[model samples]
Target: MIVKKTDNGLVMDFPALPYHKIEWSPQLQALNLKQPCVIAPYWCDRLGTPSIKARQGGRRQGELLCEIKGNRVLLYGSCHLYLKGTIYLP
Candidate 1:
């Protein structure tokens, strides 16, 4: 996985996968949380198959939604692919 800051926000790059799941950690959740950000994935499919299994928050495409809540931030996504409840962030 590769993460880089762009003019718009942060972008994440991941190898195309047949199936994948990911979750953001506390440390990762703290990046620029106060502002609206977009985490977009690069190269997210294999022969049109989705890299991730999330239905929302763009997780199905290897992305996630980040928002500020209290002192920390929240990274939310429901990934259902290959295995249940399996998630990896970066």
Candidate 2:
């Protein structure tokens, strides 16, 4: 993963493949759900179901745009796994 510091927060660039899952530790998951969380997928303008449900054939790339404000964490990006949007923290 390539992490780049930005004025808002950080941008993480990582390789992603179809059906690839990004799992978080139990402790982190608990801490993250302490606040309101929202998830928004990229490429929503595209037709058909979300990428998470679609079958990806080859290696694809995506990014994670992360921003923090006070106690909230906002994440938005695109990938085969379709993990994008806002997440709250305790």
Best by TM-score: 2
Residue 84 of model 2: what lDDT? 72
Give the lowest summed-lDDT range of ten residues in model 1: 46-55
lDDT of 1 by residue, 33-84 (tens): 3222222222222223122221122333434454444343355554444445
Mark the regions of model 2 whose C-alpha exceeds 4 Å error after superposition: 1-58, 79-90
Candidate 2's TM-score reads 0.28
Q: lDDT scores for all predictions? A: 0.36, 0.34
TM-score of each: 0.26, 0.28
RMSD to the true structure for each prediction, in A, is 14.2, 14.4
